[model samples]
Target chain A: TNVDASSSNCIFHWKNSSDWIKLNVGGQLFYTSRTTLTNSDPDSMLARMFSTSSNLHPGCIDSNGAFLIDRDPRYFSPLLNYLRSGSLILDPDINPKGVLEEAYFFNIQSCIPLLEPLTIPRDEAPLS
Target chain B: TNVDASSSNCIFHWKNSSDWIKLNVGGQLFYTSRTTLTNSDPDSMLARMFSTSSNLHPGCIDSNGAFLIDRDPRYFSPLLNYLRSGSLILDPDINPKGVLEEAYFFNIQSCIPLLEPLTIPRDEAPLS
Candidate 1:
């Protein structure tokens, strides 16, 4: 579909054609597409929040109207990235435990396997 | 981030955690993540329609409350796939022209470069 600026019926042709959503995760602000959230998991909390047929409304919103999620934002990027792509690319500096927690909160089951390998079992930890 | 089912403050812990969104495009049904649509392009129409901050409401809806879009559904899958991944994986049987037209209608500028190579200019057609 070539860009049709003159297509009267086309939504993209409208003057205000931006659907970018802002998320206030914890105290940080992040921008993303609704598709990314819904595609993460059909059973995930994020998916249901955006579902039009669902009776549940967003629990909170910031002054800017971004969805308010009271969770640590530090680990959200990887989760979002995982949703965009089917794989998780870990950040070496980030603690896998934290990300795993966030993934679980979001009910991103696919992310669990990817994070499992990075988690060191307590019994396996060397004396420290 | 761990899936804490008992966490009272966590939204994902709610019994109804699914946030999946349904979209009706050109009479066909498509399921996707909000992130995919917004991530495709901040300036695109799909992004704006899903943006909570935007004043424009969705134009149409099916009985199920799926946002209705008037356009050819045939080319939507590829566009959606491209949004999920940053690349367009074309189907051999699908016409690039139709996909290009749809891409233009959605204002998916990033898809244009990926599709341009597939479109054979009229001048390049061999005598037939």
Candidate 2:
């Protein structure tokens, strides 16, 4: 979704259409929709970046015309998938610990619960 | 998510732990957990495949140890992602038409709503 620059009252306009919003995560080029990123979590960094009132990164496009983040790309797909759908489908090959790190970095709490089941051991011993 | 083969009463026990269930879609090897597939939609092919009483394809693992399906692998990732998360964040580069086809094949109704906005053009004409 592109921001309407000419409209004085358009509160939620991106610099360009979300299709052009490319992300550089750990040197890997990724593209995503603004609605998908902002709708991920209201308290997330992405939400704040795309918020109408927030001046954090009005136009998150970087020097190379991509939103840059110094984070592991291995777990990004799951994280973005979670944002888009509201559920987390982690790759079996990727360690949950690494994905959790990215979740915390991005403030995606919904995923923490799913990952916790995998990371934390259940108390199988019956208490006396 | 392993099916308790020993327990004659465990209706939902998968033939094996869901983590080991591999899906081979269109000659491409793809892995997925049973929960993700079955939970996608109670009316989907996967739900029937993993249904407790349905004898359709119990223990979906094929001779090669992977669940086989002849479909487009390119859009399968997004379909699996949608199933896991209950939302669809299709790749911007991937045509919505292809993904919609997969969604229909898999019986993911939730995604159809999201994709409809993209596929069906909004009638901008005012009521005459």
Candidate 3:
């Protein structure tokens, strides 16, 4: 398929593949955050972030200090390197539980949609 | 049962009623927040609160701009006054979907337990 970035939806090439899959601009995120590796104190940064941070990361959320953001369950899949090691650039499953709790409270609709299929365990949904 | 506060649970009294059934300090919240609805501007306060507010209210959480905090499902119950009106002290179901979403992510164990019984629609439970 002759696809280009100009359109809201298009086809994109796959690595070492001859065919392209349909891509929707709105279906997925377009931007990514780059947390530069610095010699700064990791402990201090985590503490400061937990106390008060905008997004856990770029697309991450926090629910106090108890829950972290479980961005995508597919990320939890037992395939890629993230399954074995925590060395991925955009591993969304590395936050706290409070953060996820926060998500449940605020965006009930959106949260439900995103969480139900992610195959989250039944014990974690929390009381309404 | 000669219930007492000294116990892990106990019985309490009411200002109007003569007899007391039972009370569990942990079962229900023991404290509340005093916004001190003083001579403060509702607009600016809300702005400041939303942009960088921790806990939309007591026992409240935030997701993002798209969703607010929804504390409890029963809180959404129509009765007493919060149903026909909107003036309560501890309304739980008043947050955002994103907050709930966060809960689904990190604390899938706890989230599923609380959210499931709350009767959230299936469509809302994301593509987990």
Candidate 4:
């Protein structure tokens, strides 16, 4: 669990006690496995945060010991779903624009195109 | 957080440090607030678990310190959403029947009616 202060590349092993991870997004809580976070997009912020090469141990932690990510929970929920199911299905009340912003912040490149079309208003001035 | 062994009523003050709580449902992790768990259905198991009158302190704990609930995480996701938004929207790939069973298990009476209709097959052999 020790980190070399002088090295730019952090090397640490993922905890083997459990594959499941607890997350606190903004003020909301979410639980998912390490696989779900990294498998979706290896380059995403979430993936990098939980990956073995990254130093996630020093991240902000909630009272419950869950890693804290400062992002809107409402938007983060749908992104978690997308990571789990590989589909961009948002609840009717959820704003696609909000989810889109979160997707970009998380570096989830795959969800951008799926969300971009939904963000556009159908009533927009038809490309005159 | 003391529970009178002789009296069934358990008296406990919810931790004041954070309204947010961590949950581990059948190995899956989730983070949510105490309000979201109880506000939707005051009489449900989740509400009772987080309620001041219930004995939730000694419940199972995960390695990361999340309260463990032994339930199917798949179906639990939609129920969590229902609690959040009071809407019964399910992903296209999710089974309505599964969610219905989970709703019943959690004693979410309000969601049962919404899910029942969705569970019935419209193509069923005309009521012989």
Candidate 5:
């Protein structure tokens, strides 16, 4: 039965090539994996876009078939990296407040706490 | 005089949309800018690939019109990031030795010294 199940799994999902996903966020292009999007936050809009049964699946695609997201590319970069590494390090030029807004829009709950601290003014920030 | 020069500059290079370049590196997608590649290392192969007068302009392109570079996507990620920012940070799972080899292949001369320290064995590494 175990051997039969393993063979069935391969048969059901034979197209391994589609695992990589491309996106045209704002004007910048990005490439990531379906596993990263779905596993990062199963409840988020990004996860829903890749979900076959979800209604939020992208309605727009670029000429290259990359999903089009009308969000700032600068903010999206860190968010995507966060999903990949679970680390939310941002470049010095990136405003934390902007990233926080993107996290909220994407509904990446895991990132909110991590970003909130960064958004707080230095004077009011907790002594960590 | 300044206004006349600025207007001629705009006319000569009026197409703003083509500044973004996409690449399919080892089946993974990447989005970057012509400025990033050309400015990173004017003498590097990457810069040559984007040069209009250079023979190395990509001969292979994927179905999505992204330049096809047959290389390890894992190592390419950090290199791309390094080009974007002057920093050479790597994820814990990424090997510095692999990144060094890629930097050499790509002819990114500026990155060699920054990466050499990370590739050295702990005992042989110079103290900061």
Candidate 6:
């Protein structure tokens, strides 16, 4: 489930390849980043975005130097948005910070945080 | 994400309610019990099956215990299957018990365990 608080748009569904079926809000579906999209190889960039087969979860900042986010899918860093030259700002209703915190409490780490400067309140800034 | 080792089939996808999109065998979709099911509704049975709205999650074994499985949708007891009653039997390819065990280890209690005696091997019987 890719939730863009920035756009207040949430995508909850399955993946076959690069194709995505948009989820209608207020529906019951579980999103888990599962991907081995039949049409796209595991090496493909789109595959990287949502594939659990790799064991290299998207935002994983490993001790090893093999990171793909900013380069391929630009994971963790929200590196995708940064390169595109825009912010992945969130909305007040979604509360990206708070939502992720709650999800973390449930131990769902794969729920990637999409924090963009546009959405952070004027009173807040990313902590170093 | 509905996984039936019964068919050695795993369909992980987003639901608009009645229609289910299929997921790849080894992919990431993050299946949660999420559903208000826009195409469906609060009163619809299909909506009841997969929705997260209305504060009702599927298969909730509760303290007060006003449960929903076995009647309208058949819940905690694999109510959905008993109705069809063909036996939503599982297959050896997917070890339902062990998978739920590991998920439980990580505090992921939502991964539903599909236990049909056929797949449970002759020695195992669900503890009452």
Put down candidate 5 lDDT per residue, B1-128, tens digits, no spaces.
11222222221143233555777888887766666677778888888998656678566888888898888977877777667555565655568899998899999999999889888899997888
Candidate topping lDDT: 5
Shift in Å, residue B121, candidate 5: 0.7
Candidate 1 docks at the CAPRI level of incorrect
Query: Candidate 6, what DockQ?
Result: 0.02
lDDT to native, each model: 0.66, 0.62, 0.26, 0.72, 0.72, 0.29
Error of 6 at A4 (Å): 29
Instruction: Please tell me the interface RMSD, in Å, for model 1.
Output: 16.0
Model 2: per-residue Cα lDDT over A13-112, one tens digit each? 2323322245687776554556667765788887777666656774445677777788887777667756655556544356788888888888877778
Residues B1-128 of candidate 6 have per-residue lDDT tens digits of 23222311212222222222111112221111223122223454434544445443445433322222322111112222211122232222334554443333323222234433333666576775
Where model 3 places Cα greater than 4 Å from the true spot, the runs are A1-128, B1-90, B122-128
RMSD of 1: 19.5
Considering summed lDDT, which 10 consecutive residues are worst modelled in model 3 chain A? Answer: A30-39
Model 1 misplaced regions, further than 4 Å: A1-19, A122-128, B1-128
Among these predictions, the greatest TM-score belongs to 5
Misplaced by over 4 Å in model 6 are A1-18, A21-49, A52-86, A102-128, B1-3, B6-128
Q: Write the per-residue lDDT of candidate 3 for residues A32-58, one digit (tens) a residue.
A: 001111112223322223323324442
DockQ (C-alpha based) per candidate is 0.02, 0.02, 0.01, 0.05, 0.03, 0.02
What is the C-alpha lDDT profile of model 1 across A1-128, one tens digit per residue?
A: 12222324233334221333557888775555456667668877777776555556767888987789989976876676566445564544578889999989988887888897679798885677
Residue-wise C-alpha lDDT for candidate 3, range B4-83, written one tens digit per residue: 44423423232212111111111111111112111122332222232234233211111211111111112222211221
lDDT value, residue B32 of candidate 6: 17
- Candidate number with the higher DockQ (4 or 6): 4
Q: Write the per-residue lDDT of candidate 2 for residues B1-128, one digit (tens) a residue.
A: 65454634333555344334577564357776667777657887777776565445432223356654544465677888888787778655665666776678777787887876666545853455
lDDT of 3 at A62: 35
As a whole number from 0 to 100, the lDDT of residue A63 in candidate 4 is 89
Return the clash pairs for model 4, or none.
A29-B31, A30-B31, A31-B29, A31-B30
User: How would you encode candidate 4's per-residue C-alpha lDDT over A37-81 as one tens digit per residue?
Assistant: 878788898988887676645288888878888889878876786
